[model samples]
Target: MSRVCELTGKGPMSGNTISHANNKTRRRFLPNLNEVTLMSDALGQSFKLRISAAALRSVDHRGGLDGYLAKAKDDELSSNALKIKKEIAKAQAAA
Candidate 1:
């Protein structure tokens, strides 16, 4: 897989790496990504997703990611992805 956060849609960022001598070099800023097995409630199974730390935080900030997975485990959007639509729905309900 590419150096990206599939969950958060985070991709490589272009930037400059400055040296102590005031020299600058082109570099890429990558997100903190982890390969984790996320549970899908709808499919009654677990799927792997390459997600960034920020993305994980976003999910966690809204109550709990575990709760979202638990709720989704019983739905058809259980595998492959946690499902953007379901997450939006949950967020709206909480609001």
Candidate 2:
């Protein structure tokens, strides 16, 4: 699987690794991705997602999966996450 955050769309960033010898080499800064199951309060279901640690904190800060998806940009979300977002929206709207 690709090393990307499903929630935040975080990917590896290109950078340089500087050494003590004043040498620089190309390097990649990868996001800290973890597989976690987050529960949606609105949908009352748990969804497994590959997300960064920072995104996890943001989710908790926002409240939960439903709250996080509410403020998330469509472009930043993965297909699965987008589907969940839509379902949550539909459910909340029905209620």
In terms of lDDT, which candidate is strongest? 2
Position 48, candidate 2: lDDT: 96
Candidate 2 overall lDDT versus native:
0.96
lDDT of 1 by residue, 1-95 (tens): 68776555568899999999989999998888898776544334565778888766766765555554444433333234556445545655676
What 10-residue stretch in candidate 1 is worst by lDDT? 70-79
Q: Over 4 Å off in model 1, which ranges? A: 63-95
Report the lDDT tens digits of candidate 2 across residue range 1-95. Answer: 99999989999999899999979999999999999999998888899999999999999999989999999999999999999999999999999
TM-score of each predicted structure versus truth: 0.62, 0.97
Q: Each model's number of backbone clashes?
A: 8, 0
Worst 10-residue lDDT window for candidate 2 reads: 39-48
CA lDDT of each candidate? 0.62, 0.96
User: What is the clash tally of candidate 1?
Assistant: 8
